[model samples]
Target: MTAKPTANTRTIGSHFTRAGKYAVLSFQAALTIFPIIWVLSNSFRTTDQILTSIRLVPEQFALDNYLNVWRMTSIPRALVNSLTIDIVSILLLLAVVLPLSFVIARFRFRAATVIYLFFSLAVLVPMVTVLPMTFKLFSELGLLGHKYAIAFIYVAEQLPLSVFLMVMFMRTIPSELDEAAIMDGCSILDLFRHVIIPLSRNGIVTIVILSFVAIWNDYLTALVVLSRQADKTLSVVLGYARNEYAVDYGMMSAAIIFAIAPMILIYILVKNRLIKGMAMGAVKG
Candidate 1:
């Protein structure tokens, strides 16, 4: 037999649990922020100063490292390459995945289960496992140095997960909405464009943000596919910069900042929308 706890004991246990939760959150916040602060501080100091200094704050601040990183590296071209790939790939994913996911979620076709199973299996296949075959296929297709090829690959790579997520989110929408649209004499295309697309806005936004971040940070695929210095993505170019700069922490830090800033800024701007979308999807799902 189990006994019910007294008010005093319950209150004490709740207090201790709250304290533990707060302690964990504080520790996590510090772990995430400290490295970023340290890097930002070191970016203002010289390579030698960074090596010798033990303090987080720099005695002197200068922009020379940033200037050198911009002028000396192919980062500018890499930025252009990354943006092009990310934008085009995301657009392509939306074009294909949205409609298919809607169909899978709303319809009762015999092949729907089979199709969903196919994409689900794709999610389980590790991307790295096919790098050799991917490289050879792209090379043979004469797309090794083209930005569009990378964009194509990104769309294909991201499609499975994005479609799966959309399907899951779409299922949580009320079926009555579909019935009402159809009763109003809406055609299949009209129903999709007007009812389904608008209703799935939150899920769509979630996929866009996730895909953007994933493509922006991808390095291995870009490196293997884009061999030319002028065509490499930001991550690939950063690797080259690291090799060239070697132990120069100041320039390295600046390069890291440059590579990461665009994505961070994008996230900051859309974070509110992202959080709302995720929360709504979670509750609906």
Candidate 2:
């Protein structure tokens, strides 16, 4: 028989395995974090310094880039527009999806499977597939220059994944609680508001973050759908700003930072719940 490992040998092996995991995780964290640190540093440095220096940290820092971007670019206007679109898109998404997801999860219906499968397919359809169609449709409908119209597009794009996750997460909530609420003389809408929405908070937050990021970063929809220079979203404005600033690395970097700031802030706010929602296997079939 092969020798059974002694206590000392097993202890060392366990420690070695643990150390390996730590090392790998630390390296992965560095890879993820280094670029953010470098971008932040460069955002504070001049173009010449950025081009010449291979350093992650800047020798000197300045806010001139931010000031120039704020003054020159329509970032402030675009920021407001994007914020408005995101808010509208998210609210609409929640209103439609949460109730639909509750219906799909709580009550068995003939079309539920078909509808869920339809959304699953939608999740797989790339945004580019409908770009031409959307462009033509928006143009035909005289919606080309409309800013809020983008909110509808964002909602449609986000609906599939949001519905999928919310349905799955809602399924994880005990049906007994739902039954209890219904038996307590609660109406269906009241049951949904007090039972489903409260229990599905994690999934709600998760989908909000995902939807916001996708909508905020989407350049093609903004480019194709919203034709007005005055009404473009922040992503499209960033493109114009990049072109205008062409080799001005500092301003470009600052604009990029502005693009990502909202995502970072939202992440910080909901990170714990997001992690718990994702990692706890909350979205189960």
Candidate 3:
């Protein structure tokens, strides 16, 4: 009883749908890229030009921003401090969280739900609320302004989320693997090393990437704990940039670009594994 669409009509409908999607996608892409493009363009412009001009491109490209940021600021030290905190915190998170998560996921215990609830509640408590007390404790311990001390705090703050992620991932891994390993005379440590850790590489990598990014970008905790200028992380250093010098837009842009470069490179390298890990966890859980 219904008339079929003519070829021309069908072609027009298809074209419109395609055009609509492309238009939406193009806008989203532009929104995402615009800031980065603006920063890069401004990084090559002089301070006067940046203040006076709204143009996206500089009339004359200059490398002085990069040179000035490197020479004037403690950017190199900040970068190193950020990296050290990120690496140490992540390693500590892995060392502590992995085994505990494995046990919690694999075993049934009377206090399991209670323990899980405790950790879940910890995540709800914001760092800002706890920082005052924590800073006092760190001061009492004489650990304030130390990179390792900051790393420890990062690990503690990050643990709940890391444990939750690892537990969920470990649960998805079959108990049969553990039983088989045991039958072959594998100890708990051996089983974890050989069977569990190997299979959970994707999840581990995802955790590593996420944790690193969080720690690297963290400003509040670092500012609170690292009062020493020499020990300040990249995020903290960037915050103090204006006070440290006359806010050179070009140099500021250059520092911002440098700060984000490592995270961008990491995302590019591990994006596939990260996607796969999330998919696997979501599907299995």
Candidate 4:
């Protein structure tokens, strides 16, 4: 027979459990944020100081690193290019993936499973595996070094996972909703636009944020396809900085900070929606 704890003992146990969880959570958070803090701190340090110092905090603060990175590097232009690519790719993803997912989820077809399997397989194929062939294709099409080229590739790469996620979430939405819309004299397009899209907003947001993050951070595809400095995105531009400003630790740090800033801002703004969307999609799937 086991003895029951008194109220005081139970309260103490509960407090201990909560404290342990908080401690674990805080540790994890620190692990995640530490590098970012270090990078930011080092960005303000002189090159010699950064090279010499073990601690992240600089003895003397300097803003010239940021100024040098901004003025000398193609960071500003690269940022614009990244933004364009991300926005265009996201829009195209919405156009193509959402409808495709709806069809796969709502309708039963003979080739549905096979098609989905093929797409799932495509997702497993790394961009590196196809980069050479993709480069040849882009060259032949005269799309190499073009912003839209990157946008197109990003959309293609993102479609499989986006569709997969959307399909799972779409399944959670009752077929009754589609039937109701149809009974109200809604066409297929209308059903998708007014009913399905509205209902799947959370899932869409999740896809958008995920895709943006991926495309924004991508360097491999940009390196392979974009030949000109002017055409390069932030990732590629940052790569150049690694070589060109190798001795300038402060400048390099500043560039890294700039590269990560957009992603940080986006995560902060859409964190709640992102979590909700992921949870809903996971539960439905």
Candidate 5:
């Protein structure tokens, strides 16, 4: 007969397993962070240094590349445009999805299931599939090159998934709370505002963060929609930073850092909430 493992043997096995997990995670983190460090190192070096040396560490740091990038790119305007779009779109998404999800989760209407299923399926449709039609529709509406108006597309793109996640999260709330609130003379709007919305805070934050990241990082839609130079987003301007014949590596690196700064700052601010919200919301939903 085979012998059962002793406590000492099990403890040794667990230690090895834990050490292996850490080793793998540490290696992955290095791989992910190395490219960002390499780009930053390049941003501080001169064009000559970048071409002549492949070293990840620059001999010394300088501000010339960043100063030049500021002059060459529409940093101030594009930054404002990107921030406005992301903020507006996220607000619109939350405002619409919150009430809508609450209704679908709380009520037993005839078409609730059908509406939920429709939104769930809509989440599967890729934005690329409708690009041509979307372009034509916007053109016909005379909204091309309009900065604030373009946020409508971001709202639309994220709507279905937002509804789906919200509904899932809202469903997890106890229906008993709704009934109690109604018994206490709460109206539909009041029940939603005071009861359901407060309970689904984590889920709502998750949706906002996800929507913000998705809209901010999108280059394709912005490139096609914002045709005017004045209305172009940061990603679009970054794409055009290189000259046709000659590309400046150091300046391009600085431009990239500039473009990614907002996202990095956002992550730093909300990382704890993002972790908690994603864990509590998506997992519960």
Candidate 6:
């Protein structure tokens, strides 16, 4: 007969398993971070240096590439445009989805299931599939080449998934809280404002970050929608940064660093909140 493993043997086996997992994760982290570090190093070096060797350390560090990108390129204006669109779109989406998601999660309406299913189906539809129709509508309405038009389009594009996500998160919040609030003579609006909003802060933050990142990195949608140079987003500006003859590796690296800096900063600032939120969500869910 086979012998059962002792507790000490089980503990040793678990240690090895955890150590293996950590080793794998550490290696993956290195792979992910190396490219970013290489780009940053190259952004400080001259074009000739980049062509010669893929080095982690720059021979001659200079800020000229960054200066050129800022002074000569459309990066600055494009950043402003991207920021405006992302922020405005996220606000509009939250405004519409928050209350809608609450109703869908809490209330039992005749068409609630249908509404939820419609949104779930919408998430599977490709944005490209509806582009031609959208373009035609925008052109007819004279909304083409406008920044706010793009922002509104972004909100519409993201709304379905946003609603679904918020609904799921709201479901995780115990209904007992809602019942208690109702018993205290709280109106629906009061319950939503005072109870649900506070509890769902982490989920809302995650949504905002996801939405901002999506809209910020968007290239195809912005390329199709905005015709004017002044209205172009950062992704469009980065595309235009490429040289026709040969890729300016140094300049391109600098532009990329500039483009990703905001996202990196945002993640860094809110990383703790993101982790806590996800953990809470998993437990509550």
Winning candidate number (TM-score): 3
Per-residue lDDT of model 1, residues 19-126, tens digit only: 999999999999998888788888889877887875478777789888988788778778888998899889999999999999999998999999988876756667
Identify the superior model by TM-score, candidate 1 or candidate 2: 1
Say which prediction, candidate 4 or candidate 6, comes out ahead on lDDT: 4
RMSD of each: 4.2, 3.6, 3.1, 3.7, 3.7, 4.5
How many clashes (backbone N, Cα, C below 3 Å) per candidate?
Answer: 0, 0, 0, 0, 0, 0
Worst lDDT 10-window in candidate 1: 276-285
lDDT of 6: 0.84
Q: In candidate 4, what are the lDDT values of residues 1-285, reduced to their tens digit?
A: 244557778899999999999999999999998888888999888877787875657676778888887788889899998998789889988998988898898887999888777766766688899989989999999988576777778888877778888898789999999889899999999999989989998788788887888899899999999877788999998888878888887888899999999888987998887666557545533
Clashing pairs in 6: none
Model 5 TM:
0.85
Kindly provide the TM-score of model 4 when superposed on the true structure, using C-alpha atoms. 0.84
Model 6 lDDT, residue 213, Cα: 76
Provide the TM-score for each candidate, comma-separated. Answer: 0.84, 0.83, 0.87, 0.84, 0.85, 0.82
Candidate 5 ranges beyond 4 A from true positions:
1-27, 244-246, 272-285
Clashes of 2: 0
lDDT, candidate 1, equals 0.84
Question: Candidate 3 residues 1-285, lDDT tens each?
Answer: 244567778899999999999999999999999999899888888899999987678787888998888887899889998888788888888998888888888777988878877776767688999999999999999998576788888888877777778887888999998889889999999988888998888668778877887798899999999978788899998888877665678888888888888888987888886666546534532
